[model samples]
Target: MDWTGWIERWGEPGVLAVAGLLVGLGFGFFAQRSRFCLRGAVIEFWHGRFADKLAVWLLAFSSAVVLVQALVVAGGLDVSTARQLSARGSLSGALVGGLIFGVGMVLTRGCASRLLVLSAQGNLRALLSGLVFAVVAQAALGGVLAPLREAISGWWVVEGGPSRSLLALFGVGPWDGLAFGALWLVVAVFFAHHSGWGFWKWAGGIGTGVMVALAWFATYQVMSHSFEPVQIQGLTFSGPSAEWLMRVLSEPGKPWTFGLGLMPGVFLGSMLGAALGREFKVETFGPGYSLPRYVTGAVLMGFGSMLAGGCAVGAGMTGGAIFAVTAWLTLGGMWLGGGLADRLIDGRHA
Candidate 1:
């Protein structure tokens, strides 16, 4: 089904990037409209409310798993090449790095994805933080911090051993994708009806879940069929943000690909969504000097997401969809970290 051969009669390299942009736009739009923040979702539970945000996230995750499984059953996609399930994934890194990212998001008041949406609404704080995040993430990934990160990660990244996926652990193959997906589907259905949920929230969860699957499909099939195939991947923010910056500064004319295109799409789509929602406003730093706080937090998040291999949307939602143990470990670390930070913030205000 070499799509590139069929489509290349009139095809372009930017096709993958363009697909990423369109999908990313929808992801950003829904994220903003639904106020989807995993930190807020988790902190809410600690505040004694029913963690509606968490439930919504589960819906997205479970739904993603189900869809991915469908692709496996149909022999339409492969998750092995995805970073979340790859050998480079480290249990130790996922725990430590995810904890750092979680706490950082709590302080910054958003994750990388949220930062983009918040910036669209004129939050200068988010804008600054996002910039710091991109720079630091790039550094951690392949710049000054790369050596240290490699050192820390090499110690624990499983080498030639059973992979971290449950299916892999049990010596299973693609059918496990479907089994795992169905498992999450049930979890999503169980939390379908929560009090105080609006129509848009439900829609956002389902829509985001579908979008994640679309990401998998688009990259796996479309890119595979292209003149140049890309490593199959789903939605992720941290590393791509850095890649976007590098592309802008050094390779503005470079052809678009799935990840690079997705970054700007999320940013642009968030702005459109904010404007439509009438939530667009020129905002500045909150009470008393919080600029430094966000910068510091952004630094932590930059390194953290890179170390953990993904952020909330990447690891928490997308990776968790396939029941990746690494995603769960990192997600658990994020919740614990976010809870701790929320309590500290509460203590200060109390």
Candidate 2:
């Protein structure tokens, strides 16, 4: 896998960006086709239904875990240097930010990635909210909100490496993690079968997970071959969203990276998916959706994602696949927060 030729042709950042674009294209296409949304899954779960939404999400998640662990076991990938595992983490931020993000998604009717998908499909509401989410995410990353986020993140910290790796904390190895993933994959299969989903639904869900694994693998490969330092990363929305936002407004000359390519790749891929499916249609706010509600939700999600260090797909699926401890904690917080929000808010309306 000599990357010298590719790097010489496209530069380090260009090569990484291309890898990100390819991965993001697959993820966006599959996610759009499968109608994958964590918000939908959480809502369905809290409402006591193991239906298509839950099945799709389960399939995506379990598939990512299985594939990622398998890569580790086969020595095809090493995540030791990935930020999710290598950086100091904040338990408090993961929990609190997860909770806030969960509530925000429920209110906004979609998570960050989902919003991007819908926006690509011509959903005006999602377009606006996604823009707002990116703005607030940028603010949280280094704007006025940075101080507050830093304060919260400082409360309970965990050292990187073993302390942040769930497998290490539990005295388990990649084999064990692979087995766990396999078990859940079986569960996902059961639910998918029970839900009577069509081929595209199930296939698309699995494809989305595969993209997550590929992102990890691809980035690692780029890092291994590059002459310059490259951080191995997986699919994530928070940091990328902030990075892309800043790239547009402040740092247009910033070197191309995986995240830079990912944002637009998802958008274009989603557009292609929608066009092929004939699902592309302009939609906007109407009865039951208010401007204020969406704005508030976007703000919460932006802040929460930054505080928690990732969004639903970022922390929940991508990091979860690698068995990152803080990521798991954040995921737990999201589920709990989503459930509470649905019960308290949507329940009252019902």
Query: Tens-digit lDDT track for model 2 on 49-153?
Result: 999999999999999999999999999999999998999999999999999999999999999999999999999999899989999999999999999999999
Stretches of model 2 off by over 4 angstroms after superposition: 348-350
lDDT of 1 by residue, 285-313 (tens): 76764887889889989998988888888
Error of 2 at 264 (Å): 0.9
Q: Estimate the TM-score of every prediction.
A: 0.90, 0.98
Judge candidate 1 against the unseen true structure and give its global Cα lDDT, from 0 to 1. Answer: 0.78
TM-score of 2: 0.98
Q: What residue pairs clash in candidate 2, if any at all?
A: none
* Model 1 TM-score (2 dp): 0.90
Clashing pairs in 1: 3-225, 4-225, 65-181
